[model samples]
Target: MDFATWDDRVEKFRIPAIQYRALVESLQAENTIFNDDAKAFYQVDLVASLEMEPYQHQSEALAAWKLAGRQGVVVLPTAAGKTYLAQMAMQATPRTTLIVVPTLDLMHQWYAHLKAAFPDADVGLLGGGSRDKSSILVATYDSAAIHAETIGSMYALIIFDECHHLPTDFNRVIAEYAIAPYRLGLSATPERTDGKHADLNILIGKEVYRKRAEDLAGKALAEHEIVQIKVKLSQHERERYNKLMQIRNDFLRESKISLGSIQGWQHFVMASARSQAGRKAMLAHREAKEIALGTDGKIRILTDLLAEHYPDRILIFTADNNTVYKISNEFLIPAITHQTPVKERHEILTKFKEGEFKSLVASHVLNEGVDVPAARIAIILSGTGSVREYTQRLGRVLRKGQEANKQAILYEVVTEDTSEEGTSARRRNEPQRTQRTQSKEGEKKGDLKVVYGTGQKKTPRAAEQLGLWNDSGDTPNF
Candidate 1:
């Protein structure tokens, strides 16, 4: 085709310049009808073989993929149909693909999704519970790290799900060793508080596209109303908390522990909580007084919240198995943990989808790639210090519904004046790219928002409220 004809086609078809270049390179190398000039080598057929229908933003993403030579991150929100984008990429390339997931649940989810979309394609699942070996293989990071040398040499494409977790040594090693010519990393929240996400950018490719949560609230994602409900501690718990604090202070001072070192603080806390020899004296001092355990009250609060919001799907997250068991038993909600049997876990998830179960109490299991979008609400009883967990847990509830503008409710129950409060504050204050840019002079300052309540207001102040750094102006219900 002549330059005028090529230009006309490009404009008419919305084919990007880079895509035209790649296509022309392929066509000219095959000795198709063309001129020999360098400029003549820059145009080709403007056709896309993408099987799935692209979302509104997918065209923009396609341009980005073309611009970046199809090697970079695509940052779409949880329910923004990123999986569809990956499907399109697979269809466009028509190449053998290897999909790596962070967890077994996601490995299964991806396998099922790909199978449903491409029924005739040979799909495989390589994880703790699934059979392996197929053209489109879904494998866990742990499993891939061990066999990537053999598998990675063959696949033409490699797609990482929940790719934010790829920074770890095993996954990175596998990605680097993989011979796949095409790489795509998918994540709802790609940045990390520890500032290690730059490693992910390098491990996958440059960030080719990004669509933020606020940008898609009403357009591509469900609208969300974040609420914080606080419960007060009883008087009997107050006296015991005071004595426990005094003992913790004395033990820490005696042990000369430092919070600046994460490992040291972690070891110190574990010792204090679990070791009889290390902190038995401290517990003994508080044992004489009536101590209140928050698990029962927290479970009751969670069940009541579910009752209040019945018929809506809920995913409950907790940090410990004890908390998960308590919540599951008290509410009679099916629970999934690391210890849950694989067969039973699948059954629980299936029942949840059929509306046989309204809620699922899990210990950090549903935080990534589980495909539990029926959940309209999330209750975070406890979480790690990392901001990624907070984002992932929130993403679990942000998936779109048949009803547009679906409401997502996230309730965070934090212990006043405890490490939980500090962790929550740290999560909210972590900087984002837009927030950083908005801080410039002459720019509009972005509004600061918090998912959890500030522990400042209460009808009757509880004992734990005395030393709490609650700047949010709301009391946490015990």
Candidate 2:
């Protein structure tokens, strides 16, 4: 959609009418390149001189900043060089820069990327495990919230990475304390289903730029194939599942109760079990139901898929620590999670990059903000219908590399006829009117389909050397 269309929708969606008109009028009035005070000495030559060529869309985004006076959020997709845009904002200011990130992993990623892009300048990390002493500081929202007063008025510009998280009071406090005249917020999936878009708009900046997934597919990306593989419930588990369903349905029928209720939690308990003995039975029934759902069986099948797609770098993401541990141990893959020691996590990630390991399992630690671009394959073990998780996992494999037709395979294992399927559908179509064009057209068995990223970067030769694959095409011991 055009800028005018977006502005109209923003107003219709309860955006402050005055702010909407004012922002548009301001953009119309100032067609100048940019207006930062510190940018007087800034020149386009510096960007060209940095040994990086900006893509057409990247240049357009930069131009939008200049034309719009650089006062809005720029929503670039993951792997779309958001770091470059953040760097450009920093260079334009040429003063102290404070970048607020959502996680420690991303804090380090930004710190490392910034230092490499501008080797002559000092950069510091302010996350859990890093020191904080450079003019350009990378901090987690938790740190920013607590230390806002400490860094008060020292920065000329503030850049929020994964800025969608700022709706929380803790992170938003940093923006309130900051005196920086220039601000830029970046994210691949910026909208939350909870209707916090207005707070996100003001908390960061306006939505000044956006690009959908389908637009990049087959051009800057590969043609993706998504397949849904279905498995039947084991006989024993199926018997238990059918019995439990009958009991729950009977409760609903007798009570004239609907699942969709404002006070659903209490009703769910009453429906599932009416007494202490019944509760115990219901808990056992759930355990059996989960087993019948085929999550563990699906993981085994996924491992077989990896074996077939051997030597391919894979990232396995799950929301449950139990599942993360289970997959890592069952598949004998090196794993990293939030609980993993920092040094250990760093070492495993380095090994993954160096091609020493073929696959790694993780919890939500790698969900967003962090950059693990060497990963060409991803399997989503479990998560709520989070659009951010879906997009970020896709980004892990979308970065340009040597792997031709390298795919971002997301295996979402959901229990048939469960609430999980409904949640998955909701998230799959989360991106406003863009959903029609963003999604592929088809329906398969169950409710959720396996979503894969269609883009290939040739896998480096190192992937093979690391023992991720062999001539026999089997899972590697590493």
Instruction: Find the candidate with the highest TM-score and give its number.
Output: 2
Error of model 2, residue 65, in angstroms: 3.1
Question: lDDT tens digits, residues 1-478, model 1?
Answer: 2321334645543322223344465676897897523221111121233365566676566456545655678877676788778887676556678888887767777777887888777778887866577778898998888886567555656788778878876677667666454678888778865567798666678777776565556666677756544343456665666667677666666777655557766767677776664566446433422232253345556767787899888888887787788777767889998898878988998998888988888877776666674678898877776666777777777777676768788887654444445566665544322211211223111222234322323232122123322224321110
lDDT of 1: 0.65
TM-score (all chains, Cα) for each model: 0.71, 0.72
RMSD, every candidate, angstroms: 15.1, 12.6
lDDT tens per residue, model 2, 335-403: 877789988887888889989988888877877755675666666655656777777766676665666
lDDT of each: 0.65, 0.62
Candidate 2 residue runs with Cα over 4 Å from true position: 1-50, 127-134, 218-223, 245-289, 292-296, 404-407, 430-478
Runs in model 1 lying further than 4 Å from the true structure: 1-52, 128-134, 192-196, 254-256, 260-300, 429-478
TM-score of candidate 2 on Cα atoms, chains taken together: 0.72
